[model samples]
Target: MFAWFKRKFAKSEAAPAQQERHFMRNRTGARMFAAARQDRLGTAWGGTPLTADEIVDRNQVVLVARSREQSANNDYGRSFLRMCRQNIVGPKGVMLQAQSMTARGKLDNAANQAIEDSWLEWGKRQNCDVTGRRSWRAIQNNCITSAAKDGEFMVRLVFGADGGPWGFALQVLDPQRCPIDLNDQRPRTGAFIRQGIEFNRYGRPLAYYFTTTDESEAGYHWGGKSYVRIPAEEIIHGFLEDMVGQKRGLPWMATALFRMRQLGAMEEAAIIKARTGANQMGFIEWDDGFGPETKEKDDEELTIESEPGEWRVLPSGARVKESNPQYPTGEYAPFYKQALRGMAAGFGVLYNNLASDLEGVNFSSIRQGTLDEREHWKDLQEWLIESLIEPVFEAWLPRALLAGLIKVKGKPLPAERLDQYRVVEWQARRWQWIDPRADVNSAVEAKNNMLTSPGKLIREQGQDPQTVWQESARDVAAMIEAYKSEGIDEATAKELVLLSMGRPQPKVAPTGGNTNEAA
Candidate 1:
């Protein structure tokens, strides 16, 4: 009785395991594997629950093998044995043998057909998604298979406007992960049944796989069938933002200097003068016939003045012939010529002064210690020439000459005809005397040299050169006074002290050879 009870319990225990294994042989095992592969690939699945069509196709096949002893005991066992030998290879003594050859061939054909159809449908879906969204365009012809052990899948992708390619691929062996129901009516029921006849639980199935590249090498590969989580729109937005953030061109200091030079040239030129003089006068003669006095009185006055040996002329006897002493014939001098010359000279001085002042201001502003100081000074110099120097020369020089303030040699030309002289000697001489470069150089050098000397120290210490010279003069005066008081004659005392001080007046060298040689 105890043996029977134990045997019955053992049979019941074996029933569930046997049933689960049979369920795997149908469709559950294959669907589970596909679901696992999908999980590995990371593709998104729609909200719809898992269906049998997504997990296992009706054409899919699974083969099982039976033992030889079981095959010998029943007809069903023999058929099952034959089917296993033709497809699934059974474990045997010293060798393994396929049980169902025809079933294996049919399963192989169905697998190949399923893979091809899936790949075609995937391509169509990808094109529709990329093109419809308008973020991607025309696909390139290059398609490649993955090197992974999972079901091999191929991919074709499109190139961007800048010629970079992007797309997705499926891995046929690994497959994608999917959700499934436990009941028979469910789309893919075999996968859940493989876990046993537990009605309350569901199973995840492995279906189509999506992948870009090997996980370890994904980021290293670009312009391939690798799919990035970021959308193309976000990338383009970032690029445009960066472009808008940049700046262009030179700074305000340089621009302002350039514009000032351009506009000030003409105005500056209208003020420079070459030479100035003040003594030109015009002489005018008047006709006595048109004088206020009558002609008879003018003739009488002429007759009296014509008498010889008489310095004084007698008054005319008749009042009509009387000469009025205060009355005189003359012409008034015009002051316009002198005034014009003075104005021209004033303009020349003004132009020169303005140029000098601007140069000095620029020099003072530039720091000598700075590396760019030389360049800054050069720019300022160019500005001075264009805005101040050249303009003054072109416009003011001519106006000065026209106004008669500028003269040729020492002679002043009339304002109306000042341009007659091709070369104005006096103006040229003045310009040579006031040479801007030589004057500025001499002044700069003198100032620099003066700053380092004992004379400079004395001045800074509050002593004056004029005061020292004056004190020396006073000492000589005192020595003269002492000599005169002591009756030591002034000339002798002066000579004695002058000799003591070694103050002999310098004698001019007679010629070149008379000067002492350094030897």
Candidate 2:
């Protein structure tokens, strides 16, 4: 029985070896031509021998430094930034709302008001925006636009005596000055590992390396020790991450390079063809001409050099022929539109938004596209609020309160409770209804059924409900006062308000006529 078991085990092992030999043969016949015929050739994608660091280095130098990446801001990249502004920042940029949850169900209106007023005052100060050129809205637009164009933006906090415990100013940095190479000058605990960002073993960033001056400045050293180390706490980095463990930012225009460049070349060629083709070229007869074809046998071959804005003079008896390619510019539109559509996909924006083209787009199609695009914008807004805005507010809150620059309920807030007041809400960009009639009806029905709330709808519109209600109340009071001044009653004024809001008044029966006749 033992001998029989050994034989069975040996046969089982042999069967696997035989199956392995068969399995080793390529089962998928769709491999590339070169790998299919060769026994040793492997797939090209996985065959790359470089490590992650090497790959990043190559991408930094070769891809990030490309001319297209630099010019992207003035080129097609504008559309991407425009979308970011329209969907993320809107006209007002990001708005802050301080809601104190420490008060339990009841809002700490005084505390919230104090925090908001102080922050607003601090932001409105001259040079509050470190650049000294931008207002709050302008700086918000600048930071977002910079991140989109350059793939990353770094904001430095300059704290000093402008107001509060310490007045703070924000300065956005150029990514070019931030080096991505490792320096041996730091400790060996991986605390200063990786490019511009230095991280500890736990992978938390500690510092950043930045150059002393912009390279474009006059008398700037092209070759020198121009780097300075900045602590991570003083900086806010804004970037849309595309890969895990990616140390640097990459522009949204990176993937669209191939298509953008090709379209540019094609259109440039078309322009040349159109403009040059319009010029008439003539061949002169031998009567008394200098045309190459009309030159005498004894005379050297003659040529009329055509310079821009220079007329080509011809003798009598000359025959002119149109050398136009006759290719219509409209032919390039479809190709451009198709390429633009693909590029828009890479940008994560709708083609209609980027191209501003509504051709062939129905309500359902546009709505679907807008819904997906809005979701992505919302995600971006959340990231910005969480990563950039929240941290800044937290850093600013304690300092402002301790400096006695801000007061809660007309008294200085306790420093211990600073953390409690730090909890705040940021309103992101919102959209108006595409079809207000239907959407408003739906919203009304949902509200009546307790499926949604006014606050939720107000937030969806990128507004603070309290603010909206206050404004509306003020408007209603003003309307009543104006109607009273004109000898109209409060009820009539309120009815007018309803009528203005698209709620029509019911028809009344005539006083002395039949009800049927009135109807």
What overall lDDT goes with each candidate model? 0.31, 0.73
lDDT of 1 by residue, 1-519 (tens): 999999999999999999989987766655766654455354675435544333222111110011222224433333322322222111110110111112334323222222223223333434323333211111111000010111111222223331221122221111111111112334454432221111213423222112332435323222233233222111110000112211111111121222233323422332221111112122222354443355465443223224566576333332223322321112111232233223223222221121222333344233321223223323422432332223222332334345344333444434443233221110000012134576556655777777455444333323443345567789888887888889898788888768766677658757656555532
Candidate 1 positional error at 76, Å: 99
Summarize candidate 2's per-residue lDDT along 1-519 as a digit string, tens digits. 999999999999999999887766554453436544534455344544665556565665455555335456335656677788777778877788888756577777788878888777666636456556666666677777767766677877778863223477777677666765654435656465576677886768788877653435543223345567888898888777666666677765678767777877777788887777676454434545434453456767445677899888765555445464666556688888999899899888999988889999999999999989989999988977876777777777877887787786568887788767877889988988988999999998999899999899899898988778889889878887898889988889888877876797799856765766778
TM-scores of all candidate predictions against the true structure: 0.14, 0.79
| TM-score between candidate 2 and the true structure | 0.79
Query: Alpha-carbon error at 75 in model 1, in Å?
Result: 99
**Candidate 1 Cα deviation (angstroms), residue 262:** 32
What lDDT score goes with residue 154 in model 2? 81
